[model samples]
Target chain A: MAAAEAAGLIAVGAGLAVGLTGLGAGIAEGNVGAAAVGAITEDASLFGKAMIFMVLPETIVIFGLVISILAIFVM
Target chain B: MFKRSVRKGNYAYTVTRVKAKKSHLLREEDYDKMIQMSVPEISRYISEAGYQKEMADLAGKYEGMELLEHATYQNMANVFNSILGASQGELATMVSAYLEKWDIWNLKVILRGKSYGLTGNGIKEDLVPAGKIDEAALDKLISLESIDDILNEYSRMGKVKFPADVISDYKESGNLGVIEDYLDKLHYQRLLDSISPYTQPTKIFLDYIRRDIDVVNLRTIMKLKSEGIYGEKVMKYYIPGGMQIDSKFAQLLANAETVSAAAGDMSRLDVFEEYIKPVLDFDNYDNKAVVSAIKKYQEDQAKKMAHMYPLSVLPVIDFMVHKETEVRNIRVVARGVNSGLGRETIKGLLVI
Candidate 1:
């Protein structure tokens, strides 16, 4: 029972951190997205190019998600 | 679109827009070609590309240098205010404040022009349209009856103190630096106060400011030292706010701090070393010193700021700096062709 309880606690903590990490990533990505779209609005031909930079920040959140899944599911 | 200060999600949208515009900036090859074009050819090249609408609008109203100057400021204002419009909350807030650097430039133009009896129309052509204050506010500025009128109007829109008494005194003396210092000091104080909450970001931001201050202070020192103005008087007009050039540092510098000590403290303060050290060296370029200093200011600030966190602000800020440099280089090339200047003069003005 104690072992099960400790695992549950660990899962909840990682889950919480993942949630906060998403929030920070959202803030980070928000700025890039705004600038990306802003550039597109000036010239639509930039759509493809802007998309690349806009997606660059997604890896941060992906890293967080990977760590969280490793901690919860790998065990 | 931004009605509030940037908070969380605002950065992504703005950075998105900035990236698209970044691709359109003049490449080095384009600049090379621009150097060889005649004035009309330069105008035609711009019209064929992105500057068409502005070139058309300005083509009739002015020509040569005047036309180029007006179109540049208009596009610049549009881009700057566009960033503000696209941002909201804290993101818009910081961008708006920094753009105020242009207002300090504009106001200096006005006060100096007014002192020289240059017409309002002549003075108006050079003004950049950003700086957080509204167009209506800037319009009110151009039509003002007195410097006090400008001050009172600015006070309503923001927290800048208008040195009304100083304006009156300086009007009689016809000393332009008095008015320049007021605008400079007000802008610097506001910038410093705004960035207090974010320690690392503020430090990084102020380091740019310090490097900028060092350049201005050094130029003033050089000019004064040559003109026989005492260091004390030179120090007075030298606005002291930068970490390295603040009051005590200025005094120490005035007292002849070793070039290494001054350079060491400044490099410690920020990556300003790249900008400061070149000029501090014994064999630094004496000709076109201001152009080099200002160009390094723009380029280094761009590199340092590109890595800032919360990526929204940095991308926009980076694009604006790059765009401004682009316009400036084009203008330099255009003017060089008109004046029969060699490519070296035009190239000297280019930041990239």
Candidate 2:
């Protein structure tokens, strides 16, 4: 019972961290994505490079999600 | 630090997206290449680059400087107006107030041009698309009989308010300086008072702006002093809003011939928060101090920007400023190339 309770609390903490950072990652990526799209719209050659940076911020959320999932199953 | 999760996803996303867009701006290589090219060649170069569609589209209606100006304004409008529409909450509130600054600038342009009796075409070229006013409204405003008419139209539409009545007295007094000061004070007051942020990002942004204002005031006082203009009459144009440019600062600025002298004489600040802290003895160097100080400010801004990855309000503002500087530099380059001017003169106009 003690172990279960501890795991539950840990899961909740991970969930909160994921939620916060996930939103942040989204917002952070959003700025770049819009800017990239804007620049690309002006210049098509810019499209390839812009697309890369736009997706770069998503790694944060992906990391957060992986951490949360790992915490749930392993930790 | 701005609270990433505290804000709406939509707002955060927009800021991030805009930040990415600022990265693709023309670098020094492009400008160097452009400098060696003719006007037509430059236009073609930009066409082959990012401005292809815009150049092709605007090619028919305009050519040369007109085309370039239109392209620049349209692109600026499309980018910034999108930012204005996309963001929500406090960030939106702050950016919106700052954007409305264009409205103030537009109004001034309208007023000054009208006062000078500029031709319609003359006034139109100077009007950048920085305000909420649409093209049609701007056309109508330009054709209006008086500044009062434009203000009245805005008031009637409930789109905005103008303190025309307050400005009227100053206008009648035959001192444009008073009217200009009144307009600036009211604009800054409304701008600063309306935007409240829960995040430190907001504070930093406002401090940056207020610091910019203080520098402008300090520079203005310096310029006036060098010209031997003094007394309460000339000082009436100066406002009291910016922190460092208070009474003591103003008095010292108005009195000192050089920056080092001013720094030595005034209550010395251990740190100048917003602007580049002037180097020791900068006060004594006559007119040259202003240029050095401005360069220092730019370098300081670059340092701050280097720490943060590209995105947020900073990038957007940075792009606009850089674009303006670029445009000014290009104009200098264009004129120099066409007229066979010295490289030093052209270099003076170019900012990094």
Candidate 3:
């Protein structure tokens, strides 16, 4: 019973690790994406550059995912 | 008590779009080339650039310098209207309020036109229609028969109201100077009152406007002082709420015996040293040169603020100022070319 409770707490921690970072990435990307789309509407040639900026925040979520995987499997 | 939340506008999108539009404005090289071109050639050049629609639309009615002038004005109106449309919430409110001067300008044009016995078409040519009063409403106002009728119609439709005794005052004095001064004051007063300074961006924006007021007051002081007007008489022309030119400073500047003396007093202030001092220090000061220097300083300050706060109204305001300068520059070039002025002379007239 004690082990089960500890495992459940670890699960919650892992969930939060991914969830909070994903939320942060989403907020960051929302701003970049809006600006990117605005620029793209004005000049279609900027699409590739805008896309690169739009993808920059995704790395944060990837980092969170790595941490979550380690917390669940390697721990 | 319920607290109202501070409403935010879509700064990211608006700023980005404005940046893109700003990039498309005429560059220094373009101005250099335009200086050598004839009026028709310049018109064609602009038409090929970004003003294709305006050029095409106005081509039927106007030609030569008039064509360029009308096209640039129409394009400016369209650009301002688009910015107003793209902005939301607080940004929209600020932009619309800033553009409200155009409304006052249009009304003054109509009043002046009516008094001068100008026809509707003649009056319409001068109107910009960039404010809350759109082109159609301006057309309707122009169609009105008399000055009183136009004023009545405008008061009903416009956001601002004419004084209750304005018509009577006009009749009594037969001078629109009183009414025109009242409108100018009303524009600045309304602008100051509408802004709340709720956020950092707003605080900076308010500071910019106060600086603008200071510039205007300084210009007025220089003009009045040159005319040998002083003290309380100068105070009548002063519009308050400047960043530096307070009542005390205004009085000090006003009481100066000459224009250079007034400028010397102004130079003691750090802010005025760069733009104001060099231009006004000499006797027989060219008003146009002083105005241009002030405009350049304002533009530089705006560019700095816009850089510091990218996702704010500063970028938009900067773009608007630059766009107006572009239109003005093009008009100068066109007019200079039409008047058979030399390239160097025309270049001197350009602000760029």
Best by lDDT: 3
| Candidate No. with top DockQ | 3
TM-score for each of the candidates = 0.76, 0.72, 0.92
Candidate 1 at B195: error in angstroms?
A: 1.4
Off by over 4 Å in 1: A1-40, A45-75, B1-9, B113-120, B171-174, B197-202, B255-287, B308-312
True contacts kept of each: 0.93, 0.18, 0.79
Candidate 1, residue B4: Cα displacement in angstroms equals 11
Model 1, position B242, has a per-residue lDDT of: 64
Better of 2 and 3 by lDDT: 3
The candidate scoring highest on TM-score is 3
For model 2 the local lDDT of residue B244 reads: 66
RMSD of each: 6.0, 6.0, 2.7
Docking class of 1: acceptable
Ranking by TM-score: 3, 1, 2
Candidate 3: deviation at residue B325, Å? 1.0
TM-score of chain A of 1: 0.82
Better of 2 and 3 by DockQ: 3
